[model samples]
Target chain A: MEHAATAPEPGPARVAELRRSRPRSPLLRFSALAGVALLVWAWAAGDIYESHLTAEQKGANLDRFLAKLTPAPVRESGDWSDFAPWAVRLLGEGRGAEAVLLTFALATAAAALSGVFALIFLPGAARNLANPDPLGIRGGRGGLAAAGWHAVSRCTRAFFVFTRSLPEYVLGFLLISVLGPDPWALVLALAVHNFGILGRLGAGVGENTPPGPARPVVAHGGGRLGAYLSALLPASFNRMVVYFFYRWETCVREATVLGMLGVVSLGYLITDAKSGRAFDQMVFFVLLGALIVLAGDLLSALVRRWLRYERT
Target chain B: MNGALQRCAGSRRATLLGIALAALLCGWLLGLDPRRLFADGTLGLAGEFFSAAFRPALSYEDPVPGAQPFLLAALRSLLDTLRFAVLAMAVAVPCGALLSFFASSAWWPDLRRHRALGLALRALHSTSRAAMAFARSIHELLWGLLFITAIGLSSEAAVIAVAIPYSGILAKIYSEMLEEHARDAQEALRSIGAGGLAAFAFGLLPRALPDIVSYTFYRLECALRTAAVFGFIGIETIGYRIRLASDEFHYREIWTYLYLLFALVALIEWWGAAIRRRLKT
Candidate 1:
């Protein structure tokens, strides 16, 4: 009898709370509906229906390509033994070994360069620091001072977004054109894109860092820079390193293909093989690139796992 | 306290040493020379390229008689890129969701209640995980090249190529999200006599849905970039036009296309952010 009386009393209030918590805003519904409509329109107007070939023709084309994929020497001798020597010769004489090394080196150099650059520039992008009163420390109360800080913050964020938006391949292509296909162009392209990403990520880390440690630094008159360097940086170091490794793994994958821009990496070798109509060699290089990416992934995962353990 | 501080300093120093060693190795392998960055005429070319970025072309840098307008060409390229990205996502999302179920062990029956079924599910889980790893190891561009080789470069082949790696990525993340969420609600529902799938759907899915959606949006953004990259292989996306403009030394035209791509990405990011905020409520 007591449960029934109390339940009845709170039922209406509880229902009201539930109703308020649900996402029933008309604008949200409209936006979701609009998104689905746009997708439907995209499919209707897409260029995916361009091929006029019948199904048999498509199958035949695939079969012909598969036939070409058999290594030429192996096909002639009808023996799998010829394949091993051919692959060994390809690695020894076709510069495959050098290209593999170059791919890894390019990724490491770009990742390290970007990590350094991002660390240097991220303070300007951090919301907590770019304000007039950093770390919640009161400063001169002037509208002009606030406006200036806001503009700086906005411009820095916009710059990061703009650089991040430019696909690395596109940037590499543009850079290679002006730089005459130099390795520097590839390195710069990868670094610039990753720098923007890391800057954004590192700024987020700064904003999300607990205010407790940083407040004491500000109270001691260490200034925003000192507080950031001494407190926030150390607090977020493991996370930033984790992000760095994640980006490095991506860089390795990208470096594998960025070589198709006419540099010498796994991608360049693969492209060369494709043009030479050596399907066997092309597939081999592609698999080798995949292997490198998997290795990079494993290494990054292990480091990230260690970092997570450190946090606990 | 003193020993802990010393250990921290030692680790920091070691990390720095490792980075230095890696950078030196990279420099040696790449034959890197700082002097080459400022080689003769390089500064002039770079200056010309950056200057054009400020004044993106409103039309063709060099006109040809009776040619289509530059803006029309750019618009077409933009739409094609969007279409390709959307199509790839449409295929990848469903495939990924299906693969995720097999990959994730969260919904498995209790081992004590059903030993044979549990072992079989474990076997399926491992195989799905291995497949996902292999699929994700290859970059989408490489996958595109492989598909083009195998199937003669049709639109379907291109779409499939992009979809393959994307599905694996989405599946991996989705499974992780499912596994990461707290199982309190699921356990409660199960205790109340709900079916296993029902308990998972109502309890876990709701908690993980927002993250899964947010990640899918991020993947869509990536797909747009990948679609542009596909143009290099002759798919008539924005990258294709950029390549064409570059070939003719039309840096301004390249910038124009680049700005359009950036605007599209920024708009999508804003929309995704707004949706995520709403989901949080």
Candidate 2:
């Protein structure tokens, strides 16, 4: 108690100095204020509560919906034994299995194609490679050559940004109309969006690479393309693969939903079930989609873990 | 050592080969046809769609006497989309924070110090993590469909649908960030007799706050996209307008809505980057 009483508190001068030393950024303040303002305005708009259904109607709808989710056979027989056969029939006769396979195929094809395209185009967006002074080589090209390289980099980046901004569903919606419901429409939609993401990610990986092995190729008077192929590509291959799997996981999720555009995937089946008011079938297909996503996530995680283990 | 390095390189090549083979197999299974890409009349439609990009609609292509102007309708839908996104984020952020708190193991007390409590906390952590995974397994669109089927497509249904998966995703990332940050400060707090949760709150949460905020902003951008997509199911966002325009073969009008969406996404992305930079400094 005597020692505690003798301990000096933080003096006013020290407290004032602490306040002065705190990190400050006007942009952050503005952003926080804007975010709050937006929230207030959104709440005041009251758009979220706009519904034609009365409370009673909504309650009834919910009750009916949940009741409908039980398998019809089980609901009638009151036996858990009926569920297995019903599920088996749904998987076999109802085209659910085919839809699942198609969803997986769509994701694989799109991700592979995007990975290929990204490899080809990402170098143009990579600052280290796109610069005239490639790999920081001394006395590199100047003036017009430098300007041309800069232009290519800028244009490539802009193109990636444009594609990345378009949501996959929006792209699929437009492509389906233009291409007339072909599977190519869905594949292309997924591919285009993912190409942008992969390109950007690949460019970042390339830029952040140590530039150790890659510099030797440049020093040996190799061209930018030569250096990229022989050194940077090999050095960053594992990292690129990791990003590919990450995007592929997302592509699987998107492909499941893309089928709602009416081509033929898990999403289409879910939508069809809903329109027919086969709530039981809808729930089954939704669960099936969830299973597919979980499987995809597991696969990607395993591959990423392997990659990490090998690298270390 | 040289032989081992060669073997490592060989395995890497084999992995690449395996991936390529898998892709080919998937392509074969899909039975993709090249002819369908060039199906009759697709070129004309594609040309028309591309051409419309340069001249987005300034007014209705086929004007109706009583209908509001084109720009005004686009503006309204844009605001609706933004409002829906904001509402969803409002629900998601706090829910995500709470979920992440339970999901993470970072705040757990020393097991030796409180054995029974530690076991309970461990159980809670696993349960929260499993719930997060299950919730995140389904896409938000499907969640929206489920909610709409159950509740009949109100704004609350849409917001909740978006919030569910977003919260799960945010929680997962937030927990990872919390775990990844250094625990020196937290340990110091604990050594001074601070409670586990208190130390985490004061010492660790602030260290992870900037990253968490940045990611939340990113999630808000995603929520905006999801909100637009929900317009397809009758939420009256920009996507609903795009659907309407496309049904009428109003390519120019569709482009207008698309450009508006793109502009909004671009603005939010820029704002997020600025905020992140500020936080870093």
Chain A TM-scores of all predicted models? 0.90, 0.93
For DockQ, the strongest prediction is 2
lDDT of 1 at A288: 86
**Candidate 2: docking tier:** medium
lDDT tens readout by residue for model 2, A1-312: 999998657899878988998988888788879989999999898764468999999999999999998999999999989999999998889999999999999999889988999999999999999998888986366799999999999999877766776778988998889988888888889999899889989999999998999898888888789889988988888999999999999999889999999997899999999999999999999999999999999999999989978763
| lDDT (tens digit, per residue) of candidate 2 on B1-281 | 99986886787799888878888888788877777667668888998998999999999999999999999989999989999999999998898888899998778877798889888988988998888888888999999999989879788888989999888889988998999899999999999999888999999998888798878877887887888888888898998888888898999999898888878877887788787777766
Off by over 4 Å in 2: A1-10
DockQ of the two-chain complex in candidate 2: 0.68
In candidate 2, how many clashes are counted? 0
Q: List the residue pairs that clash in candidate 1.
A: none
If chain B of candidate 1 is superposed on the true chain B, what is its TM-score? Answer: 0.95
Q: Alpha carbon lDDT of residue B89, candidate 2? A: 92
Q: Note the DockQ of each predicted structure.
A: 0.65, 0.68
Scored against the true structure, residue B255 in model 1 reaches a CA lDDT of 94
Candidate 1 CAPRI level: medium
Per-structure clash totals for the candidates: 0, 0
Candidate 1 local lDDT, A53-121, one digit each (tens):
677877886887788788878989999999999888888898888888999999999999998998988
